[model samples]
Structure formats: structure tokens, C-alpha cells
Target: MPSRFRAWELCALMLAVGSAFTSNFAGADEKAEGDIPAFVGKDSPVGAWEYGKERGEFWKYRNEKPTATIDASSVGKYADKLTPGQIALFKAKPGYRMEIYPAHRVCGVPDFVAANSEQNKTLAKLDASEEHVVDGVTPGVMFPQPKTGAQAIYNYLLRYRGVGTSVSAQVTAVSPRPGSDEWITAVGPSLNYYPWAVEGHNKVVGGGAILNGISFTYVSPAALAGQGGAGKIYFNQDAEAYYYFTGQRRVRRMPSYLYDAPQLGYENEYLVDETGVFLGPPIDRFNWKLVGKKELYVPYSSFGMYRFNAKFDSVFSKSFVNPEFRRYEPHRVYVVEATLKPDARHVAHKKVFYLDEDTWIPVLAEDYDAQGNLWKVKEAYPIPVWELGGTCDFLAFTQYDMATGRYVSDQTTIGQGKDVRWFAKATEPWMKSDYFTSQALQSRSDR
Candidate 1:
């Protein structure tokens, strides 16, 4: 057998052992069914709620109506309806308005995703312990009709973002200084492999027990060229990451690349886990609360931004990514609040996520600082990939730092050639589990 296959086999064995232990202690079969709560607005079934030591402060279901729903064409006319924070971030330009339309269920899951979701629902009832395990999930959305915040998040976590995606993109950071349009950009190639989403088992390239693998190598801006990193995220364990340094001609393990670590020297504006709106593990750090469904204006089906001839200056303006190409639609979103645990430590104290009901992808997120004030607003521009039979988000996302006026736009194809594309299916034969290891990082580096 090949060495890579043997490594995967060993990984699978370890996962089996881990699952057994999880089943025993995690109470995989404990059901949280009970009388449905009398929710006010859009009533949905309630799921399990975990309690914190802070008495009377535990997170609970908060089902309520949206503050206001306006048309995207008349967003400025009803500017008073928006919160102060909303107005500041979405300041409308002439001939453009942030219209909030009627809500619709536009998200559609693929058959495989639906099948896996049904299987996950059954497994959750049979062994509640597997509720958060991503390794054993059968290639689909984990919780289709999520009742709790955690379950809703799991839907995003396990959402089918393609089995593998390879893109040559760019990351641009705009300086906060006034009258300074100076921008620092990093051009690179990014490969993301979700082993858990791969169909069947291919010992050479399939992820035996891992959830996802990502590798990125910067190819431009001379100084950052040759700097690369690879990481593997497990279903029930801490993620493992490694960084390749050209000077040393070696790869070094970077265990601290979790939570709020600055990503690729983006001036601390972007965190490692903030990609794709909310991408990291959520069960342990934050106590999530499902705040019910609300109608909101969010970016949806933005096909214009994906044009091969799009320019960076036209796409990215001074204050915000020009809203001209941004398409907004009214959609019922599952509002989830994540509060930093008292025991856990992080920069953001609170985060409110707006997940589209249809796609289960976070469209907008408001990050609060230590003082409980809105500090950063993150937006995900999702477009439907017709070939994939579902919506794919974050083709271009902007992270705006309210305090600093600086923002970072990652995974953007603006300015780069048309080589940047989202593959609905895995096309690369080398997208295997072994290809994301630290050793692979060293070998792939162009030193």
C-alpha cells in the first residue's frame, strides 16, 4: 500500500476510536424533544439549549419579527428604518438604494446534501453525541431545518461548498488613512478540499476522517512571494496548520492559527476563522442563540461581480465595495447570536449572523468589540453556481473595520485574469488528504 493510503487508514482508525469515546461520554443519544415554545413571529420547533454557569443568562430561543422590510430600490428613502450602524455601513450613493424586498426561500440543497441531512437528523436522534461530528456525516447538509443556533450553524459548517475548489485570487487591504487610496494586495492561488464532501473513498486523495483541507501560496508582491501555508480541519479536533518560510526553506507548525489570529498579515483586520462569514468551530467558544427568522436586505446572486473583465477599481471604491454590482434581495434569515463564553478569550465579544434560509449561508455578520459596540461588518456576496445545483457564497466578501476605516477583501477575482473560477466538482487528482500535510507544504513551496 502507498504511504499516503496507510496514513489515511491510520487516521480512520483513530477517528473510530474517538467516535466510540464520544458516544460514551457525549451522550450521543440524548434527545431534546419537548413541548414547542410559543414563539411570537415565525414559529419553528425548538432544539436543545445548553446552559451556562451564569444564572438567568443562558441563551434561549428568541423568535420575533423583523424591524422593517423595505425594497432594495428604495433603501435610501426609508433610511430612517435602518439602524445607525446599518446606515453607516450601507451609505447609499446617487441612483442606488438598498432595497429590502419580500422574503423568499431561495436556498435549495442538492439531493446528496438533503440525503445526508436526513441521515444526520436520524443520527442526531439515535446518538446525539454525533451532532457536532463532521467526520461521519454522509456528504450533505447536516441540519436542513435547524431549530437551534448551533444546528443552524452546523448547516453552514457542513454546507456543500463543492468537494474541491481551486482558484487564483487576490487579497486587498485598503488603508484607513483619509485621502489615501493606497492599497496593498496579495496575489495567490488557493486550493480548498473538503474531504468529508468527497463521494466514496479514494485512498490516495480522499479525506478519510478529516473535514476540510486548505492550501494557499502567494505568488506576487515579491516580498510575500513563496510564502505559503496548509491546514487540515478535523471534525472533532483542533485544526492543524503549517507555514512555509522561504528564508529557512522549511515548514513550521502554526498551532495558534485559530480564533482571531490575523490572516496572512492583513493588518489584524481579518481573522483566520472569519472567512466565509463564520467558518471555524462554534460549539465550544460561543454560546449560540437562534433569534428566529427575520426579513433583511442582503447580497444575493451577484453575477456581475464575477465577470471576467471586471476591474478592481470599479469593484472596490473608497468607502465600500461599489454597491452597483451588488444584488440585494429580501430573504428570511435565521438570526443567530454568538456570545463569547466567559471562560473563552477572543477579541470580538459578540457576533450576530444573518444566514439565508434557503442556502444556509451567512450573508451578513456584525462583529462587536470588547465594549459591546459594533466594530466590524462582514458581508458575503453569494452567487448561484448553476452547475452545482446550489448557491455558493463569498465569491467576494468585504470586512470593514468601523473603528479604523480599514477593510480587507479576500478571495476576490477582480484584477486577476479569468483563471479564477469555482469548480462545482473536484477536477484535480492531487486534491487528496495527504496533499494538505506539513510535508506537502514544504514540497509545494517554490523556494
Candidate 2:
């Protein structure tokens, strides 16, 4: 219905309008760039990428992209020799240095753990399918020479921690404001039970259910007294949690308490799964990649941090735990990166875990936000439990929230004397399965 010239004019106008709209859209994106925090060091690669991508930027470096690997010829005497990319990934400051020492393979499991691991390995090899089954494996390290990242994670999950351990430990969660040494501290006692670690009980018990259990009851600051909870981890599924409110006098089941859930009175920075660096199975929520081996300055053999005479105030320093009592040693660690799946929901978009090769215990972890900014750094200090035939255990650990400057320290037995104790073997009556029951929790609280 229109002339050729008129049609041409209309097309020109439409193109002009489209160009203007695109220019405006691009301008808006440029303006929004300011909202993103300035990228530091090698983080510029991540700034250009959008958050919540199906495959995160860290996954790009999963395989051969990261050419650096720890070996006998590599530099290992000092942390200063670490690559800039490595330091940047850990969010360590420019001047930060870690004193490296000779690698020691001091991790030793009990006879039971060694025997069980051998059996588990055989069972695992028989299955050719990719389907991950919980019941097929026994206790101890599931896969000693783990080829995939998921297998390495499973090894950590099943690492030898003795058969049923009972530990009385204290948690010191400190929230400090800027320009003040004053820190609000929440001190409390916690009890841990590892039902799966029970000796002579290799098969599944209690109607073929329940794996591990923990109960924590705060006994300090008056306001938080008698306010704590208990949680049970299943063999194949997520954990079931319950919180005790002193006022209500009832234990309410909290199914939503798994993964990224905040610990009470800890400023919501420390997550349930973030405890012990990486807790529970991460197979479903994340795509794990084994970044290979690297010599790292990780907290190891830090028995001094658990001294009975050490005072909490002396050990607690501004911004971080005191380095005097903390010991760092050079150890070959398997670097594993866990990027959140697109369907998974969590505050931490990416997590980098450093696991000791000898023990398979996570020694250091870096957590990143959705915006790809480093949010928190966690360190676990390992101490060899001599009574358990040199079995290495996490003596104490700290999680630092970089943005908020708040931190949480758990498993601290320092200065608690008789109130806190770590035993290689569980105490006689407490080792019973009935001791971890929900009914038992209510009855114990009543007493």
C-alpha cells in the first residue's frame, strides 16, 4: 500500500529506533558496572561474567588450564613463591606469607578403618554405573586414589575418624566492630557423636538408618542458655535437624537446616555445611573438579592451639586468630573446586577446597559470593590424636567473613579444662545408639 521510497523511509526510521534502544541498553549496563565491586588481582576475568551462570568462571580452570602443579622440583620452602593467581584465588593480601616446611605423612588410621577401606574400594570397583549409592561403601577412606573430584570428596566424607567419638568442645563466635578491640563473644559447649564410626558395628543399625549425630547446648551469656539443637545425618540423604527453645520446652524438627543454614548467634556468616570446611555430600548441588595437587601452607599438627592453659582472649586477635599458636606446614594438597549447579540454591556460588593428601581432611577453603567476590576463608587446624594411633583430627577451626570482619571459632577446648575433652574412644554409656535419639535429647534436657 506504500510507495518504494516511503517503505525505505519507514525501514530507516525503524533501524534508527532500534539502534537508539540498543545504545541505551548498553549504556545502562555500563552504568550498572559501578555497582559491582572493583575486581582485585586476577578477578577481572570474573567481573565481565554474570552471576549464577550454569558453569561458573572457576570451572574454566578445572583441568589443564591450571598448569601449575605441586611436585618435588617445585618451590615449597616459602609461600612467597606461590603464583599470583593462587594468592588471588585465596584472597590473601600482598604481604601475607606462609612458612612452608617439609611434608610429613603422619596420618594413620586404626586397624578397623584400614580393613574397612579395603573392602569399600573393592565394592566400589565392582559397580560400573555412575549412580552414587551410600550403602555400598564401608567406613574409612572410600577411595584412596580418587580420580574424580566427587570421589575425592567422598573420600573425605568417609575418612577415618575412629569408631564413635565423644568430644566436649567450646565455640567462640566473635563479632568485632571497626576501630575497637571490644568483641561480642558467644561462648558455648557442644557435644559430638559419630554413630557410623562405631566399632564392631559395620552394618547399618537402628532399622537401617542414621549415620552421625551432634548436640549443642549453649551454657553462657544467660540469654542463650539452654538454647541449642541436635542434628542427625542419614546414610544416603540430607541431615535432619532439631532446635531446642528453652521457652517452648520442645524440640522442633527443622528439615530446612541443611546446607547454607546459619548457626544461631554466629551472625549468619558461618553455614552448616561450611563447618569442617565442606561437610556432607556435595555431589547433587555442585559440579566438582579436581584441580590436581599443589604444595600449600595449610594448618597441620597444630597441637599447641589446644593447650589447656591458653586463654581465649590471648588467642583471639583483631581480624583473625593469633598466628603465634597457629602452625602452618607445607603439605601436598588436592585442590578441588565446587561450583554451584544452576538449579541449586546457596549463598556461596563457588567454593575452593584444599584437602590434605595424607588425611583427606579439608584444611583450607575459600567461599565466593554470587557476584564472584571472595566472601569468606576457612582454616582447619589438624592435631594428631596420639591415643588413636596417630589419627589426625581437627583440633580447632576458624571461619572469617571478609566483608563483615566477623568470625566464628569452633571446637576450641582451650581453657575449658575438665569441661572439654577429646577422647579417642567414646565414653562407655554415651556410645550407645539410644544416646542420640530425640527422646534422649528431651530427657537429657529435663535433667
Candidate 3:
């Protein structure tokens, strides 16, 4: 049986989320940049220095890591702004650093959506509670007010990043074994497409059964030189993972690779749902509670981490990723906590995520083991996807195992010449569902 909040408790929690909007949201007119309700930082409007760089800044960050950094001695100044989980992580992995940067604005989902947002109106109309979204919500956020824990996490789960995105190359890195400096690493390509992603798209495709489809193939190291897999992330279920097995010379389904399963070669350092901080299954495994919307040090406008050209050695480290490659900013985030269901089973007993309020991206998270001990801490490296019309997306993210002193980074672009390519429409040939089928996986096998 799943634990649930009492009716009155649920109402109070919902009110907490609403109060966040009141405390953080500037007036609509002030927050609006030109015609688009430009999303900047929460609790503060965009600074003059942060405006106008919307799309260019994203690319510029990719080309060059930011030069300015917060002084190491002054890191304590941000102690009050960090979650207890983060402070615990700092203690677990000492010598972590922060890079301070301006929170630039991005043209948001307001400009190209058909969702029913604030009178069928938007992120700008967070006050309008008169049913502002379609049952089959597409393009824009569904619950801008986000009354429940499920609603808030759903915003993250469904936030748009265009119709399709393809990263030509993505690097993976895990810390060295205990008492040694050598590291485990792999590289691969990532593909994601949303069948119901097109603007005015979806009247609930398959009754909102499918949120997106993903495919990936890794070609590196002798052990994993030719492994590939495809999975469908449905609206309310576990992902279906399958891949072509080169040695077997056929596509095989991996049903057990659903929740909490460690990715091959990661040594249990990374779990399936740990991608981009929190991604698939028993997505409803816990009873969610909306803690509050609060200001915290979260990864925002992180371009340095995406430099496909950055040297791998510069980023991967014995404890956490190099502090220079990771940036932290003061932004408002919706804090949601999940406790495992009484009848459910998973390695993590409790989890907390601070989702960036502006983009609903989970910027920071903490996972607790079955003993209720904080086991891991995580962060996502998000840069505004200018290509996705300012809708932000994370290009890289990682988690640290506090118990083991190991960290695994996924979806990184460092050393790859190209970054994630965001599409405004499903125009590519491989954007179809068939491209993710087992037959397709076999045809595209590395071997």
C-alpha cells in the first residue's frame, strides 16, 4: 500500500506551492520580455546583463566555459542558500566549487502553444486557475500552479524540448576505484523524439500513453563496444527497454532493466531513473509531497559542462566533477519529496528533488538508501536550449554515491564536436516510432 497525505494536509501542501508563485513571480508585464513571457530567474527579474543573450549565450557557453568563478574562500557565503542535502554532499566530497553567473532569460513556451494555459492562457498567467490546459496537454507546461506533488513532477516529466533532439556524441564518466586514480568512461550517441510534441500536436496520442521514445548505442571499450537499446517512456508506466545484441545478432527485450537497475559498466553507481537527475519508473513508486518553492543553489545556465570540446580529464575527478566545469546559481526551485510506498521496493527509501521553477528541470536531488541514510546527491547541467525557443534542457547531469565515494555522469557532450540539436518540429526521417523498433535497432547496430 502507498502512503498518502490526508485531505487537509494535501490542501495545505497545495497552498504552499501557490504561495511560492505569489512570493517569487514578478508581475506578468515585468516578467514578459517582448511578446514572449521570457523565463528568467525566480524571485528576481532578468538583469540587463542577462537579457538579449537568450540563444547566443547558449551557443557561446558551448564554445567556451565561463571565465569568472566564485572565490573558493567565499563559498561559505552560499551556505544558507543550499539544501541540507547539498551541504551533506559538500561534506561527503570536500573541495567542491561554484561558478557564479547571471540568469539569462529565454523566450518560453508561451509563443507557440495551443494548450489551454491561462484562459487557455500560460506560465505568465500562473494566477489563472480556470482550467488552462488541455487534457492531452502539449507544447507548454500543464500545471503552472502545480497543486500536488504529482503535478509538479509531471511538469518536469512532460516539459517540452521540441519535437526531437539528437546529440551526435555524449560522453559518460565514473570516478576511479577506491584508492586509485584511473577512471571508467564510455561514449555514445543519444536520440529522443516526442510523437505528440508538435505544436497543436496531441489530442492525447494513445490517450497520453507515450510521452517520448529514446534510442542510444554505445561504441567504445571492448566490453561495451557494440551495445545499443531503445525505450519508450510512457505517460504513466515503466519504460520498455530493448536493444540489438551484436553477439546474439538479434534484438532482445530487457524487461528487468526497469527501475533502480544499474546501467551496464557503471558498477551500480547509476540507476535507470537517475538519468538527467530523475527520469523513468515506478515513477509513482513513492508518495510525493510538495515541500515548498524555495531559493537554492542549483545548476542553471551551465554551459561549461556542455563544451563537447573540453578535455575529459579536466571534468572527471576522484570525488565529484571538477568544480570549474560545474556552475551553481541562485534560483527558485519547487522542492518535492518522495517516500517509498509501503508495498513497493527500491534501493532508495526517500528522495528529494529541487526542480528549477522556471523550467521544471530537476536541478538538484538527494536519494536515501533503505536505511534512510542519504546515499547519493545529484545535479543537472542545464543550458537554455535556444533552439527549442528558449525552453531549457539539461545537456549533462551526474550523481555521487556518498556511501561509496563514486560518481557517474550521464548525457555529457564534452569532447563531442556537436551538442544536442533541438527540433521545433518532427521533421526528421528517424523521428518516427519505427526508428525505435527492435528491427531498426538491429539495422543500426554498431557491429
Output the number of the lDDT-best candidate.
Answer: 3
Cα shift from native, residue 111, model 2 (Å): 2.9
Ranking by lDDT: 3, 1, 2
Identify the runs in model 2 with alpha carbons over 4 angstroms from their true place: 1-97, 125-137, 180-182, 200-208, 419-427
The lDDT of each candidate is 0.61, 0.59, 0.66
Ranking by TM-score: 3, 1, 2
Q: TM-score: which is higher, 1 or 3? A: 3
What is candidate 1's lDDT per residue for 20-94, written digit by digit as tens?
221101122122212111111211123431221211121121222333444345457766334344555654323
Where does candidate 3 have its weakest 10-residue lDDT segment?
125-134
Report the lDDT of model 1 for residue 133.
Answer: 50
By TM-score, how accurate is candidate 2? Answer: 0.75
Give residue 422's error in model 1 in angstroms: 3.5
Clash pairs, candidate 3, are 116-120, 116-132, 117-120, 117-121, 118-121, 118-122, 308-415
After best superposition, candidate 1 residue 218: deviation in angstroms? 0.8
| Per-residue alpha-carbon lDDT of candidate 3 for residues 203-242, written as tens digits (9 for 90 to 100) | 4333235577889877775677688789787654456789
What are the models' TM-scores?
0.76, 0.75, 0.81
